[model samples]
Target: MKRPAPRTATTRHVTQINRTAILDVLREHGPLSRRDIQQRTGLGSATIERLCSALMEEGAVEAAGQVRQSVGRPSTLLRFASSARAIMAVDVTEYTARGRLVDLGGSTLYEESHTFALEGQDAGAARIDGLLGLVDRLASPETGVTAPIVAVGITVPGIVHEGVVTKAVELDWQEVPLADIVSARSGLPILVENDANATAYGEWHSGALANAHSAVALVLGARLGAGIINEARLHRGHRSAAGEIGFLLTSSASFSRYFTEQGDVDSTLAAQVLPFAAREGLHGKRIGPAFRAMMARCRAGDSEAEQARDEFFDSIALALVATSVVLSPQVIVLAGAFAQYSEESAEQLTRRLVGRIPWVPRIAVSDLGFDAAITGVSALTIEHARSATYLA
Candidate 1:
């Protein structure tokens, strides 16, 4: 049912491979002499020199400084140019829009945000305008990001499939052709991802799970969910609904008055534990404070809080165990709100999985914190920029 891929390895292809190799080396370990690059990449002296020259001409690599050798004249040390180009990454929530302009080497150069209300008949159109306006504001030359932005990557708080947002409850959006619209309006390539997936990829690629090629990231914010990376790839499943762990059942109560739906973890938590938290005199504008208080109480040795915490872990443990049995990930990463109590959360989840699974995966906490998604979107944009028709 599938067509075979065409095989065509021309001289150009080999040159491209060598070029990519040189760039990768420079990115991983830079400020090295030409001889050092030859030694590391196994490329001949002529090829390394040629590729480095081309890369420097294209603004991807530049001279860091001169290093004098004991036996020869001062050798020029080369490094990947972090500010050669820029990537515009934005995160869109229900009420807030935050964006950053990052360089090629994953450094934040500038960031900006503005709040807007999504109301009335033209809310969808207004949302689009608001997003574009923010992009224009950040892209202004006054922000001081001088490099040309090659691509843009944005995260939406909903299901994104095939360049379209199928649904976003908080934003009241459906079947929005987000990527096409944005790319057309901005005159650059666009990448669209959900917030949870973006967070998971950001953590795995450069944050908590950077060392682990395959890991599971649990997003335990006001709403609970999971992001999965398998063999260094984001596993979106067949319909792009792979990591929706909020629908997992912890107790018998999920069957009655609780159906498996999108982002149902918060509802499940409230049904099972909020009553106990309320009884303890914890309330706030949103569920975040009360939930945080409950987690704290449980760690202080409160019986009721511990019971509720265990129940909460029950739901999460089901997802982790299932993910472990299937993918055998190297680690389980705690992200979002739960990351604040990563040690305790990891301990509780480990206790639940000690005997159930043949072996337990190590648990880690995300280091990027609230910036994970933005970092991830920026990385994705860089990748797209490299593979784009234009030269890096």
Candidate 2:
């Protein structure tokens, strides 16, 4: 590989730092006068003006209005030009790929979801084609994007290491160079991340867990996983697989089988629990109905359903407590469909965790919903775009 130097690395780093400081301040605090920016960042007046001028030319900043002063001249207020560039993020799940095109401020400009069924012998290649098709659609003009698309961030359900998806049993993918492939197809920079980790990051960055010192996003969708945050930073673990909490042997459900590629959620939910619920006439279709049925029955004083509810929630709390005891986040956010019953689920887990640990973190429902990965990837791509602002 050859180095592509638009500027010396030292100069580029300092430039990015200065730009990030000004842009971040404007972004976080909204519109501000140059004096306010100077006070906020401690950068000199001349430096601020020069950078602001460059940013305005690059469409990254714009004049908001002028602040009328009691004395002397009026000060011009500048705002971060959130719509200057588009950031596209796609989150790949087991049966669907949900994506969005957002501005620098993380506001959705375009959004679409494609539900796909990948089967047969050539599933992996088909998956890639389908995914790339989605990428193309996201970048299409129907998204109403007039600005340059800086980069695309992808989040997938798997153990993502570097730019490769090491394992995604749901997608039946292993060791796929997803980032390079997407980048090649789109001719743009690509950032790939594990879905759970991305969800945790999204929650921490701008959703339910925002401002918390530490937090964990326990994803209880069709599968079980987690995104861990410690000291306001993601803990990607060895090989960036830090929050694979599904494999923990904390499930209280007695199942005849062991974990397969899908991990414990496979054995616990799809195989053992749902099957039992179906056979026992708890639900006609799936886990959501089944869980609701059980809860309703248990509330109606059905002994069997009550006991079943206790065991199911105990299993979940086991997974949560197992991760919490180690990471010790200040809060744990529940992500996925099961989170719709957040209060009920929180009650179940909270009551079950009694005496299990010294202190129980606050349990919160995910405000980002299913698009957490999209929000998270937006965060990642925003950082990448900022870093490469003038460096590239």
Q: Which of the numbered candidates is closest to the native, going by highest lDDT?
A: 2
Per-candidate TM vs. native?
Answer: 0.81, 0.84
Ten residues in a row with the worst lDDT in model 2? Answer: 283-292
lDDT of each structure? 0.78, 0.80
Score candidate 2 by lDDT. Answer: 0.80
| lDDT digits (tens) for residues 202-247 of candidate 2 | 9989899999888999886556788988887888988897888777
Candidate 1 lDDT, 281-307, residue by residue in tens: 854222344567778787788898878
Instruction: Give the C-alpha miss distance for residue 202 in model 1, angstroms.
Output: 2.4
Q: List the residue pairs that clash in candidate 2.
A: none
Off by over 4 Å in 1: 1-6, 10-15, 32-51, 67-75, 119-126, 249-267, 273-290, 293-307, 389-392
How far does residue 375 in candidate 2 sit from its true spot (Å)? 2.3
Relative to the true structure, candidate 1 reaches a TM of 0.81
Looking at model 1, the pairs that clash are none
